[model samples]
Target: MFLKFLTFTIAIGGSALGGPIDPFGSSAARVLTQLPEKTWLESIAVRRNGDILATSLFYSSNIFTVTQPSVHAHNTAKILASVPEVNSLLGITEVPGSYDEEAFFFVGGNFTSLTTFSTTVGSFKGFKLTFPRNGNPTVQKVSDLAPFSSFPNSVTAIPQAPGSVLVADSFVGAIGRLDLLTGQYDPRAFAFDDMAVPKGAKLPIGISAMRMKGSYLYYGNPSTQSIYKVKVDSKGYLVKGAQPSLVANISSVAPGLDDFIFDPQGNILLATNSPENAIVHVDVRTGRSKRIIGGPTDPLMPDSTCLAFGRGILDTNTFYVSTGRNISDPTTSARIVAVDASLLNYY
Candidate 1:
């Protein structure tokens, strides 16, 4: 059975400049494109070359990429290569190399393994990556990678620090970092500690999505319906025994936040919750939030399962978001939409 919830859509009946022109505010968002039929679209990453990469658990084990024109418009996506027949492929990243080239890499949790694609080989069963695109991307097994049997939920490449990657180990309530060169876990990297909740209170939940800003690491808690920010050291390591501060409380809106992404300006944060099947935005500086998209308010919109920040081809102020047909759906039929970031100004 599909769980129903409330959502606030951009009120179109109001005056353009007087009333709420858009729920999000900036006039930067609009529905740009919809994904192909599938079931569970999980996480997305973009390459410096402007290629969009995405992974789907409900679909086959593969990495998909889409190329768009200089303008922010919808374009068809093509499957670059199928991930090895591993248990489950969860996240992908574009690692840059010398002379402005990049190597595409992906990590999976169920199998507790990391794999890199080769242009020469159709598929490489291990973690080693070889450059100089000859044929299909080549892959080799690397040593010293962190192994978490409980399963990792998400993997992200920090744009500010190239070669430094982070993985959210959901079951362990921790985030781990992998060194690109040695393919080994960096013990000095930052992560949350003292995460255990008080006797009567619930523990700080596992992180579903994370973004780095200056010396702080911002993360979303899917289980607790909260967003937190923690201070980190110079090496991008979390300060030892550091306690996370609540940036925004979402328990009132939804009990579970599936994912979240930051807007271009970094002033706004958008999140999607499963129970409510809605998207909400918050002002990072003030911790104030408002319903900007999804919910029972719009009959045409489906339950939102996941979301990410995408720039529209035409407008720099425009940001795009993608939603899965159902968080529980076993296939990849999902929708991608654009919304004006300026709408946040109304709130």
Candidate 2:
């Protein structure tokens, strides 16, 4: 386990020293909407009706909705609902078999500050939110992930495992299983040695982003600047004897990857946060990564955090990304930018 971590660290360190490569420049994307200055938009999930649901990273743990993402001029965001008592919100994903197709699960906790990574341990929780066509939306506490998880950052639904979703516990370097039906959680559902963070690290975040594709579960670790996947069973547990395989070490392309999404063709679009605010397009077959939009100093996408594909026919080819504060200039508004996926043809 130590050998694997050291090997990846060396590979990433070498590539990071080579500096970043930005091919698309700043014209490939445009800001769809933005929140007031100092508001940090952390995670984003698109609704079935084409609206974008975004979570606050440092704000009031409020969830906002940006309607008509494809039409920027007509775009405007309004506070949808705020999780009661929680100080910050992190990861959120839609639950497949819910009423009106508007049900979602999110993670939130009390954080002293994201800049300091000071989390109020044992305060993390998993919540379920839903919006009905004929009535108002509601937020409910689903599972308490404390006493085991230190920092739960991202969540993804298991299609084959109903009423269950996997949560990425970043600080603990583990993947947890949360049961929505029973409100029970197993913090070490899929812990691996490769997910460990080195001692006394500055930003000790592990398993930052997670997603499910087919029978495999893919996740990213910024501490290692790499992505990996493992096969899982119908029960949402990692298959016995299944080993995690490396998808890519993206350090050279961006400082570190925060979150990523996959297209139908199995290609990936990843977001880089903080110092290297950019988007990387990865070709899984060739293992090549290219910067598709933004850069370290691009104001349009000030701290790019997460990306999601737009729903429905009119905007299927569009990708909406959420941005936090401009680390270089905190006074700028956090934004949601739209980039045309067709730009991939030029690359």
Best by lDDT: 2
Task: Candidate 2: count the clashes.
Answer: 0
Tens-digit per-residue lDDT, 1-347, candidate 1: 11112121112121111111112322434444455555344656555544455565534454455555225444544555444444345555555566634565555533322221111111212232323545444443432244332445555566655666776655556777866665656422545542222234343346667767767878776656677888876556777887789888766655556556676657544546344655687778888777766564442224454455444443345444545565445353554455555554535
- The lowest-lDDT stretch of 10 consecutive residues in candidate 2 is 1-10
Overlapping backbone residue pairs in candidate 1 total: 45
Candidate 2 Cα deviation (angstroms), residue 33 = 0.6
Q: lDDT of each structure?
A: 0.51, 0.78
**TM-scores, all models, native as reference:** 0.71, 0.89
